[model samples]
Target: MADDNPGFSDPVTLFQDVEDLKAQIARLTGLIDRLTAGGGDDPAGPGDGDTGAPAQDADAEGEEEDGYPPFILLLDSPAYDEELRALIEWVEGVLVPGYLAEPSSDAHWCHLWFEHPVAVGRLHALWLAWQELTEPATCGYTGPSTWHRDHLDPCMRELRGRGGPFGGCTKNEHQIAHRQPSLVPSAWRMAES
Candidate 1:
């Protein structure tokens, strides 16, 4: 029989690629389920399409459901409180001590960072990317450097840049003020005559 697929000379390599794709698909399916079910907090509840298994049981079964969720979903999730606690721990323990430099006119930071939604979202995303990239089995030795160069610096620039989310705050002060940018009403919200 003729080879239907080309460029995959090694069967082992092809099998590994297929396995990786399967894992990716599983993760994406779980994400979509969570998104559609509005956080998928109650896996045993209707519309989750599960076998009435609790969410924690799925975790115990070694399913890949414990990955970090998007910030919006995290907010809506029942696990929000727990995730927030962990985020605070990561930010204070790892991010603040290691990544944060002295706040100045050029580099703005806030003591009340958790109060700012934009800062929280950005930092959470950065932390998630850090976790994924820094996994030794995943990205190996270059992971941390790649995370710093690609994710950390850019996210910090957006979070701490001039007129950024923490623009009103300072190193030791929690100004807790933000200007509402001008925006037109959404089309869905417009009153129909």
Candidate 2:
């Protein structure tokens, strides 16, 4: 008799469970639709896009789940390995390419970094930091903000400083003062692997 809140217990709980299950079903249905129907016009489907992460709402802004362009992988996410591999590929494939090509400040005009030991180590750490600072709900700033302020600026200053890695390839009169300070091309090539 004391448990007389009977209606609040079983039936209500069952109803709540049913609602949750329904919501999950609806979400899963949407995923299947996207995967089967394609990301856009092409019939190749969302998997064809394969940009690693799932698609985001074109209208949504500042409320992204993984922050932005540089997504940090959460172990619970199904796309964990995919996203991480993508990030690694971008850093190696695109981000650090300039450094390998020309390890001078003149290479990219004031922010380029050469593939020196110190530079490579710093950029690797910077990349990792980017992943951490851009977590969906953890960091204080947005992705670009965190990258420029926290990871990019400081690391760039250090890695391209007059005494920093890449021998501080600062743009003086727009000339590469030194022709690649350290870390021979062969070494950087090996590191790329």
Candidate 3:
């Protein structure tokens, strides 16, 4: 049998790839759990008392205040639309051709994925991480692997999975007939008791 995808040569290679993916998922899950609980070993997490605030570096706040657009959801920022356009370009030129697998019901996609807020958010995040990690000067040799394991694979899984934003979409199809899901009202909007 001829293997179409040159990336995976044989059945054993494919099996190994699956095993590697499983290991990566396990590691990522463990890392998330550890970070969420504010360090794995601690019963009483970071910040004063049991506040469980994420432990941030002293420079973390400064970085944001310096007008660094670390996220694409900055609608108020002047760069929002430009950043979004760049994201779309990268998705089309790099991600779709390079990373996206053949779409099936289990792993669906839509050409007009930007219409979905969830897809936009996730893809933006993935693109941002890709920029940071793939820079050889900044992240070094292990960066690409870390990005794939910690970011790309997970983001793609969530975006393309059965329960993902593209769940209702089909391969190469862009159906906006169904509106995006609505969120519950914010607590601030509710009247005080």
Better-scoring candidate (lDDT), 2 or 3: 3
Q: Write the per-residue lDDT of candidate 2 for residues 1-193, one digit (tens) a residue.
A: 6278665667756765565455446535645665566545543332322223336442333223322333332232444445455555656775667433444543332343333434445655676565544443333334445456667777766755565544534445333345555755697788899
lDDT of the candidates, in the order given: 0.66, 0.49, 0.67
The regions of model 3 sitting more than 4 angstroms off are 1-64, 176-193
Tell me each candidate's TM-score: 0.59, 0.33, 0.57
Question: Model 1 TM-score?
Answer: 0.59
Question: Which digits, one per residue and each the tens of the lDDT, describe model 1 over residues 136-183?
Answer: 444445556667877999999998888889887866667655645878
- Per residue, candidate 3 scores C-alpha lDDT tens digits across 1-193 of 3657777668776875675565456545544554577643543233221111123432443225322335666564455666678789889988999998788988888888988877888998888677656654344455677789889999999988888878878765676645565888778778653
Q: Between candidates 1 and 3, name the one with more favorable lDDT.
A: 3
Give the Cα-based TM-score of candidate 3 against the true structure.
0.57
Over 4 Å off in model 2, which ranges? 1-88, 92-115, 140-143, 168-193
Clashing pairs in 3: none
* Pairs in steric clash, model 1: none
